[model samples]
Target chain A: MTFRAERRGTFRAERRGTFRAERRGAFRAEVRDQIAKWRRDGVFEPRSDSWLTGYDEDFSRRLGARGWIGLTWRGRGFADRFVLTEELLRAGAPVAAHWIADRQIGPAIARLGSAALKQALLPGIEAGDVRFCLGMSEPDAGSDLASVRTRAVRTDGGWLLDGQKVWSSHAHRATHAYVLARTSTGEHKHRGLTEFVLDMSAPGVTARQIPDMRGPGHFCEVFFDGAFVPDSAVLGSVGDGWGQVTGQLAFERGGPERVLSTYPLLALTLAAAGPADAGRVGELVARLTALRRLGKQVAARMDAGEAPIGAAATLKMLGNRFEVDVIEVARSVPGVPRAAIDDAVLAAPGFSLRGGTTEVLGVVIAREAMGAVG
Target chain B: MSMPDVEEAAVKVLGGAADMRDAARITAEQGWHLLGVPEPEGAGGTLADLTGVVRAVSAAGLSSPLPELHAPVVLSVRGQLIAPWGPAWENVNLAGEPYDIGDAPSSGAVLTRWRILHAARLVGGCQGAAARTAAYAATRVQFGRPIARFQAVSALVAEAHAQAVLAAAGLEAALADPEDDLVAVAALATASRAGTAVARVAHQVHGAIGVTQEMGLERLTRRLWAWRDLPGEAELEPLLGLLGEERAWDLGAGDE
Candidate 1:
């Protein structure tokens, strides 16, 4: 199976006037060769979602070395990032180590971080030498970010962070933790929150893995007993964390990652299914293709400097549903054993729960859509 | 022009109602039918452009004489058959039903574009119904408070909006490139199903008023059921049948 280079400006002649996808160039050849080499070396198994929880530091660093990590900050648009990410996911590469950094943290730093923070972070991030985990959801906060109780009190030199963060994926393995904590009291719960880029090895900070349905959990519970983060570590302005986090959510939620979690299994099912299962498999591919196209459209809008906040949430919600639906449908495939797809089936529920639960996304999208009509 | 621009223009031209005679008139008066006339027909736009116009017309719940209007114009403009016309469209519905059947052209490009337009219309109709349901729930008082204040009604509205949004995204995806048969099929399937669901929710929210013609909800809801059948399950199966035979499922086909 030969991987074809993406054509430039081929589909959608209607997009002539606005927000054209970045034209394909030499990077196509580069990414194609890299993927081919990885396939030959058997670096990772194809058609597996094991990479979601898998931690291969060297593999991530290899991707960084090949300059595949931070396509966004290196003058490449989201279209380029989409191409690279789709290829990685399709190959089932172990990307969890760099996933957070490459996807959200890196972009967040590049956009909102201070110059000092950016300089210290971007290089390590791009090199895949520094791994980062998101520190958002707290014990009391899951969908409601405005009520986070984690406090980042201003200290003599910097800020003293004290509180607990839950559902932090890969915190135990990450080198740094990007956290949002309350900074000052205000009339609104969303106010007074600030984003912090913390050194995970710092004193007074503790991280413990949380057991989950899937064994060897990637989620972690992080506690801070006055962990000192320098003022330089603060990302964006103090009170502007809400905006920063919202933007980060846009980056985090609206990608191929949301929808393609179970795609490996879906592809596997199609490859191995009998003639009786053809109709179901065909419907699955058709629906998945539509959702993937939707993701690409979101990427194009983001490239054009539009947040498309509502559209992003809508895509993520649909994507979450699609991921779970694919896994459930695969259960009926004739040749594939029910146990064979259990890993993906187990992971299916988390697709929506992790990045803003289905209910939260639904509210966000409905509000935005109704507000637009108003 | 962009689809939004086409949508805006179509809304201004066709308003929110559907009529066969109006479609026939608009096809002749505004040169809407000439949008995708063959290259030899002298000064015709791309199928992508025509697809946008068709999407706009469909979204606004207006009947359109597109590929049907193409035949006479193509013969007059190009002096030859650009594409063969398919069987005439015949469907049953109270909302926007076309009583007079015209020669519906069946060119692959036109068929794909029409299906995309049909999907976009379904999305638009679904969105209209969803908006009405949300508005009704917000205002309709029960137990001394708006029904929308209740989780039951709110959740229904949210689901309706989500369905419409899903269909809209699919339609946008298909509109991006109307040429891909698979994408068109997917778009049609997603939008049609969404449209049907949205129609049901709209009625559920509106109660008996939605069934009465005075509420005018059926104008959008009934059309969704009728138009959904054009590229319905039967039509999608053959295309999907081909997809089922494939060894590898490669959905990463878009240029972007």
Candidate 2:
């Protein structure tokens, strides 16, 4: 009887595997068809780093209506999300409006947000009405995020936030901002930090767009002068924001976005690649293939409830390099549009800077490597 | 045995061998070369099983004919194929490893197989180099702290480790579908490129000691240099050009 039961279990597992694979295939096909149609209809122009630069609420709403946003929160797997995002980034879709919310914050809130917070924000997030901008990096806390001086003080039924967040992308248009502020003094720098979701239009909140080389960019400096956030808006727990924010880094850094930020330029490069340029283009594709596989492995690990922090850092490190290298390869190939190359070149610097700087990623990866050896 | 157990066994057996000749003999006696051979004639393990033994041997920094033991003869101008008992011109590569020069028939499939195995070796070499470099960086002290504390040295170690990870990923993809020539070529190209970067960074972090034979970092770095250019990125990269844009984007489609 036990042997028969085990055999039946194995059969069920096999069937589940097959079903998952089929679902993934169908979903990927659907995404490809939709992207092709969008291109044909002039829905959005393909651009490098569209995840950051492209802000089309309508496009995001369409994706949300198709149930592509908040995939993991909706009982879909990371592999499914991986397929969706890979195709979206490959086509350089206008995903920025919903990117931060959908990519990390939505999942975070689902996992750790208060009941009221979930009821208030998750539906809007899934429907593409709620957009989120990060408030982790402050003027003095670029790489050392633990040094953020943003303070959140206790109040009657909420907290009063007083600080400034720099390089908060899309804050000007985001409906919400996820900010990390210190609530109390603790033994270490990583302590006393708390993450809170603040309404963008709160009375004391102000967002000022910072013009960059790209001109009228999404970069913003957000100031909170006694902005009020209810206790329900707190993500995770007080004094544990360090752990929570670090946990989100794997999701932020490991995705296909890190690798495919410059894929539009690569597509253009491939169209213009001559026989002589084949070697160069082929090299880029080979690296991309490897990086994508690594990404898939990371996603699979995440699905299995593993953080895979080191693996994620390694992916971003190599992926950031690949993202920048695509520009040079594009430049070398004749007939690749000059405007595309210029856009990629201007966007290339931030590929390694955002999420985590290359230097910071190197530290993380090397420390992991050292730990393994020891 | 499981794949990791097979690799562990290979490492244990190969570790007992004194030199390349002894290692080759042990490999044959253990039937590792016939791991993927057909039943009755030899053990019928999967390609993945053979990969375990290949990775073990290469990671041990031992130069043997294990990877090519069952492979069909392919051209070797610098003479990497070892056949000591056969009548051939014995030569040494950049790593000072001996190989034999002889005319032999070659097949495209066999070449791809050889490339896959060699790419695995390169992947192993990169891992070995990266591990050793990282270990050294964490222990070797300067300016009252380990050099790894220095961001520059940390960057070097990270580069080596990252390259190893990338190369290993490529090898995994190729192993998944070894029969696919495009996949094999891409894997080899990625591994070959990684080998150069890993070797360079390993040497840089080890400073002058990395070059000396006594220090033993040369064992992996030299092999990396020698194996890297053998049908390296330059040779394998062009094959990827055969793929059109759509196919290139969608290569290894069903497997994913």
DockQ of all models, two decimals each: 0.24, 0.33
For model 2, what TM-score does chain A reach? Answer: 0.94
What is the lDDT for B35 in model 1?
55
| C-alpha DockQ for predicted model 1 | 0.24
Judged by lDDT, which candidate is best? 2
Identify the candidate with maximal DockQ: 2
Error of 1 at B90 (Å): 7.5
**Candidate 2 pairs with clashing backbones:** none
Output the worst ten-in-a-row residue range by lDDT, candidate 1 chain A: A1-10
Residue B162 in candidate 2 has what lDDT?
A: 93
lDDT per residue as tens, model 1, B1-256: 4346544665667663345656566556655555555434422555555556665565555555554554331111123222222233353345645433333345576566556655666776777778777777777898999777676676677778878777777776665555676677777777777877888888888888888889887777877887676546444633553353232234335444
Worst 10-residue lDDT window for candidate 2 chain A reads: A1-10
**Could you give candidate 2's fraction of true interface contacts?**
0.47
